[model samples]
Target: MKGEFMSLILTTILHFAATNIDDIFLLLTWFLQRDSKLKSSHIIFGQYLGFIALVILSVIGALGALIIPQEWIG
Candidate 1:
């Protein structure tokens, strides 16, 4: 039980870190740009929307994979 819990925790951490790795650079660039008119709130809102879209697309792809046959895939 403890092993499974630890694995789950590690997987969650790694998944989140991997997905947001690009966001770190993007947010930094947005903040560093001189002519940019975007506020921090706008950046945060855009990030949220983007993440939600990613999650939705992932779910749809996963479901499609499950529904399709292995023979048809290749």
Candidate 2:
């Protein structure tokens, strides 16, 4: 049971890291920029909103795939 729990935790972390790797670089760029007007809170909030949008779109796409006819796809 303990090993299974640890594997689940590790899988979750890896999946999250893979999904957000691009976001990590984008955030780094935002932080490194000088003379930028954006505040930290604003950047964080924007990132959150973008993530929410992606998740919503992903769900929609998954549902759409299920609804789509396989013959139509081919």
Query: Top model by TM-score, which number?
Result: 1
Q: What TM value does model 1 have?
A: 0.70
User: Candidate 1 on 2-71: residue-level lDDT in tens?
Assistant: 9999999999999999978988998999877635477777877888998899999999998999999989
Off by over 4 Å in 1: 1-5, 34-36
Tens-digit lDDT string for candidate 2 (1-74): 99999999999999999988898898999877724587888888998998899989999988998999989877
Error of 1 at 40 (Å): 1.7
Per-prediction tally of clashes: 0, 0
Candidate 2: pairs in clash: none
Report the Cα RMSD per candidate: 2.7, 3.8
lDDT for every model?
A: 0.88, 0.88
Error of 1 at 61 (Å): 0.5
Q: What is the lDDT of candidate 2?
A: 0.88
